[model samples]
Target: MAYRRTPAVQARLDAQREAVLQAAVVLLAERGYGGCSMAAVAERAGIATGSMYRHFSGKSELAVELFRTVVGREVAAVTEAARRESTPQRRLAAAVETFAARALRAPRLAYALLAEPADPVVDAERLVFRRAFRDLFAEQIADAVAAGEIPPQNAELTGAALVGAVGEALVGPLAAGGRHPDEVIPALVSFTLRALGGSHDSDA
Candidate 1:
């Protein structure tokens, strides 16, 4: 028979796992994926290197989890920013602004998430992350088209293109430590608005 963990033991393990992930986040922010080895994370979390295996099987697994943790927060922020806007164009702008602003605020972390070289597992998670943003933008684009705020277009394709555009536009700045947010963010927002073929007079 398999040995069963008691509730207390299980709770302890869960908390330990959380601590490991938190330590990994700090490492990722500071040094990207290269700095997030199990030993480094274990040291940061005040645990033995071997103990990390209790929470994650290896670096790839930990990297995927870390990517999810960071990306989840980003997605939520963009979603909330979009939710607060009344107009479709405004909602899309808000999402872009929020994403760009947050990325600038955390350049190293953003660089790691956006363009860092990492394991195939993390690359897979990155695709999922991009799709989430694409879908969010597609929803607003569809709305804008329905309301005649923008010309009829393929919302899904446009959404994916916008996601790629934003990511590519930010990659340079993110890699360069996110210089000139005031200039970069507004420029990005304006670009996104123009791409959607919507009026920017109100934003101006």
Candidate 2:
């Protein structure tokens, strides 16, 4: 028979896991994936190196969890930004602007999430992260087409392309430590608007 954890023990494990994740976030922001070894995270969390195994099977597992934690917050932020907008075209612009602005604010972490070389597991998570943004863009593109804000187009393809374009556009600046947000963000928003074949006057 398998033994079950007591309520107190389960709560303790939950808190420890959160601490481990928090420590990993700090390390990822500072050094990208290369700096997030189990030992380093354990030291940061003030736990034994062996204790990390209690929360994660290995580094790949920890890295994937870390990616999800950070990406979830980003997705929520952009989603909220888009929700506050009054039009499909403006929603798309808001999403792009918010994502670029936040990424620029956290360049090292953004570089890791956007383009860092990492474990195969982390790479797979990156695809999921990209798809989440792709879906968000596709939804607005479809809405825009329905509202006649833009010409009819394949929403999925356009969405995927936009995601790729935004990622590629930001990679250079993010990797270079992203010094020029005021210039970079507006330029990106304009490019996204033109790609969607929508008016940028209101977004401006």
Candidate 3:
């Protein structure tokens, strides 16, 4: 028979695992990915070094798990931000803002997950998460075209261009110390709107 996890027991275990991963991300970001150790992660997590092994087999496995969690959260934010808006333009702007804000808030994590291929597992998962974002953006662009908000053009090319632009443009400010995500959201929103032939007024 298959083992079953009770809700409360599952919740507790999930929380503990998340704490471990959270500690790992902070350490990985502070130290280079290669520099982080299982001991350091265990210490940061307030658990015995052996305890981390119970949750993850090794440092590389833990790192991959953390990468998946971080990318999942960021993508969820983008999806939520886009979900509430009615107009395609608003959805696009919200999606860009969500991506920028999250990346800025956790720039190191963003750089690790998006910019570097530290591990094969991370590389594979990151590609999937990124492609999901691209497809969602392209779909929004198509909707905007259908609504006559944007010109009918190369949807995939347009989506990829916009996503790349936002990712590259924000990397600097995001990685810069003492800058808040809110500080750059408006500019991002404005730039994306103009590029898509939509006005910033759509957000108003």
lDDT of each: 0.92, 0.94, 0.77
Question: TM-score for model 3?
Answer: 0.78
Question: In candidate 3, how many Å is residue 166 off?
Answer: 1.1
Where model 1 places Cα greater than 4 Å from the true spot, the runs are: 201-204
Tens-place lDDT per residue, model 3, 86-194, is: 8888888889888887777666667666665476776777667668788878988898999998877777778888878877787677457318666678888888888
* Cα deviation of 94, candidate 2, in Å: 0.3
In the predicted model 3, the residue pairs found to clash are none
lDDT of 1: 0.92
Cα error, candidate 2, residue 170 (Å): 0.5
Segments in model 2 whose C-alpha atoms lie over 4 Å from true places: 201-204
**Which candidate number would show the highest lDDT if scored against the true structure?**
2
| Model 3 worst lDDT run, 10 consecutive residues | 174-183
lDDT over C-alpha atoms for residue 55 of model 3: 85
Measured by C-alpha RMSD in angstroms, how accurate is candidate 1? 1.1
Clash counts per candidate, in order, are 0, 0, 0
Root-mean-square deviation per candidate: 1.1, 1.1, 3.6
Candidate 2 local lDDT, 1-204, one digit each (tens): 999999999999999999999999999999999999999999999999999999999999999899999999999999999999998998999999999999999999999998999879998999999999999999999999999999899999999999999999999999889889999999999999888888873553
